[model samples]
Target chain A: MHFMTALRAAWQQRDSLLCVGLDPDPARFPAHLQGRSDAILRFCTQIVDATADLVCCFKPQIAYFAAHRAEDQLEALVEHIHARHPGTPVVLDAKRGDIGSTAEQYAIEAFERFKADAITVNPYMGRDSVDPYLAYPDKGVILLCRTSNPGGSDLQFLEVDTSKGRMKLYEHVARTVAEDWNASGNCALVVGATFPAEIARVRALVGELPLLVPGIGAQGGDIAATLAAGRTENGTGLMINSSRAVLYAGKGEDFAEAARRVAEETRDAINAYR
Target chain B: MHFMTALRAAWQQRDSLLCVGLDPDPARFPAHLQGRSDAILRFCTQIVDATADLVCCFKPQIAYFAAHRAEDQLEALVEHIHARHPGTPVVLDAKRGDIGSTAEQYAIEAFERFKADAITVNPYMGRDSVDPYLAYPDKGVILLCRTSNPGGSDLQFLEVDTSKGRMKLYEHVARTVAEDWNASGNCALVVGATFPAEIARVRALVGELPLLVPGIGAQGGDIAATLAAGRTENGTGLMINSSRAVLYAGKGEDFAEAARRVAEETRDAINAYR
Candidate 1:
């Protein structure tokens, strides 16, 4: 299935916009799983088995797994998700960007090796850095615009003089990606939930494209306000991500179930906005 | 040895600030090394062996090795460079940046796993994101400020509204990282060789911190002018990088020797400015 259809299916079945972030830190894994790649795989399997039905999608922070000497484990993690729950889309949060030729390899890694339905990318390298990823018709690319971090304001909010008159740097990014590079309609913008006004402006620029809204949980971005800023005539384009708050709900054996409860709450919270 | 001392040693011996870049593409790996990791390893080993004595440092662009499914090869490539040329420092060209805890893992990976003396980073995540890497007193952290890409101006040149007045965003990043985060003197900035005035301006702010100036050969950045703008007191803190111009100088069996010749020429080009 195409990424858009997969997203629509997720929104309809789970009745939630919640994307459970699986950034499994080795230290945070269950005691039995510490420092062992097998154990890490097992923990992810259990989390997927338990909460697979509760989330619209699963977002795995690649750095956590890549940091371990077992960078190869990322393949197992993504494959496990696809094998058991074929309907659930996976977004690999790699935030990768490089030169033209190099970016193509990352596309193959994300779309071919891991088979991620979507991948987050850094736009620092410019449009050519991202063109290779956009070539994949079935996959989605989430471009980082205004990040959830406080220091993001240091750069993302800067105003510049373009041929189109004075414009915020991110607004230029949104307009270019939406109008120029996104021929396949697989482009998405990562607008932090903390800044609702900017989110609204970016949403207007990137018309029907998807918006991957992070920072709802530990980042303390207001969900009601975020939803109000991002939702359009069709409200399924936004994928709200909550990582630590849901995944590390309880440190004990019932952690999976605890995760389920928080996932449900987060789901209800977004649904209430609808 | 301290990173600055190592840089100075390479400079005094070679009388050049050029660091030859090794970004070998798998498809372009000389015909003899096709389809085999060991062959690629051998080729890189020879490249280091040939060019080590002529240049101050070797920068292995991680993206090339990472493009292959065999991520294991990237580790071997790093090991080969260090094993063959123990005196020459290896700069792992990975522009990595994450939160404090995650940044620590990257630091360990770049410094310990790969044994890189320095690595490139993005400061968009703020001081906390970069502080973990600076904890290692021996290694240097080269933060991206004004990049060489065409779209770099989109955000790097943004005019910020501040207490003092409006200032370019890259200027703000330079001031903040230098004043607040440069406590260890291991912190540096990547001022693209393409932007000479920005290079001069940022140099004034940071004061003698190492600058990794990329975009010399294929990217149309002028070597003579860049050296003039980015030169330090002793011509010791500048590590100007030239990748394709040196490494891919010849596609034939004599590629390594061709690489060494070009590297010598590049070293001469920089020294001529002094």
Candidate 2:
């Protein structure tokens, strides 16, 4: 099934829009898993096991895995998630952007090697950089729109003169990707939950297309504002992601259970807003 | 020594600005090494050995290695370059960008794991994203400015309203990076050789800073125009990169020797222009 179809199905079946980001920093892992070589895999598996029922998807940031040279563990984590929670989608948050052939290689790395249902890409290099990932019609390509970082405004918010007159760089990106790209209907935009106004602007630009909203929990995003600004017309197209707040909820042995509680709370909070 | 000092030393010693790109595509490997598990390492070692003296730097595009799960080979290649040709810098073309901690992970992946003297970065996430890579004062952080692809103009050329009135987005990037960032003098910009005018524009913007110019050989970029447009005022500070035209110059046992020949010619052509 196409990534969008699978995502929607998972959302409906789970009745949730929460995407738990699996960014396992060794320093933040529970005390029990600290020195273990397989800490990343073990921690992520337990998190998935704890919160699988409450989430429509799992978004794993590749940096945390690559830092420890635990790519094999990452691959295993994705496979385990698929086997354990068959319908839940996995979005690899790589944010890769490169020239044509290199982009193709990154696509293979994310989709074939890691087996992610979808992947995040950076649109800085323009069309061909993103086209390779978009070529996989069955997979989803989430482009970075207005990001959540403090430095996000450094470039993303620059007002650019287009045929449509002056607009922010992120707005231009949304319009271009929604109109010129997205022919395969597998395209999505990543608008930070921290920037609800930008999220609303992106939502207005791209109607029902999925929006992967990050920066909700630990990043101090207002949950109600995020849901109100990011939801689609049908109230079901935003994937609110929380990584540190849920993953590092407890540093003790009951970490997984703590993660579950936080996941539950986050999901219900999102549902209440929706 | 710092990346720029090392790069400048290598350039003066070799009297060349050529940076040979080691992007080993398995499908394009010579027949003798086609099925070998160590094909990537062997192919790259041979190329490096053949052309070590003809260039100032060696850039191994991480995507190709990551695609075939040959990161080990990439690590080995960097070691081989440093051991065999210590003065020649190795710039790993990673183009990585992320949040602060995630960026830290990528820095570890590039500098600690792969041992690259310098690495390319994407500035889409702005200051904090590039800051982690820049924190290592000894290493080089080359930022993506104006790319070589046809789609580069899609967003890069859009006129943005900045403090200095309406300027292109890339110009804004150049000004910000050159003026605000680069306190450590490790920052550089990537301006594609395919667009000589853009290269000139970027060169003019970032005075004496180094430029990693790709798209020279296989991508049909003009050598003379690139040299004239990209060179610093002192006829230096440009790392002209060519991948396919040098790597896939021959399809037989003479492949390495053929690669050396092409590298020599490209180096000489660049020298002539300088």
The residue ranges of model 2 lying beyond 4 angstroms of the native Cα positions read: none
Predicted candidate 2 versus true structure: per-residue lDDT over A1-274, tens digit per residue: 6789989998889999999999999898878999998999999999999999999899999988888889989999999998988888999999999988899999999999999999999999999899999888899999998888899999999888899888899999999889988988999998998899989999899989899999988888888999899887667999999999999999999999999999999999999988
Per residue, candidate 1 scores C-alpha lDDT tens digits across B76-132 of 877877677766778887787655656787787788877788888887666777887
Give interface RMSD, per candidate: 2.6, 0.7
| Per-residue error (Å), model 2, residue A66 | 0.7
Q: Could you give candidate 2's per-residue lDDT for residues B1-274 as a string of tens digits?
A: 6778889998999899999999999899999999999999999999999999889899999999888888888989999999998888999999998888789999999999999989999888899888998889899999999998888888888899999888898888888888888988889999899899988888888899899999988898999999999887678889999999999999998899999999999999999988
TM-score of chain A of 1: 0.95
Model 1: lDDT to the true structure: 0.79
Point to the candidate with the largest DockQ.
Answer: 2
lDDT of 2: 0.91
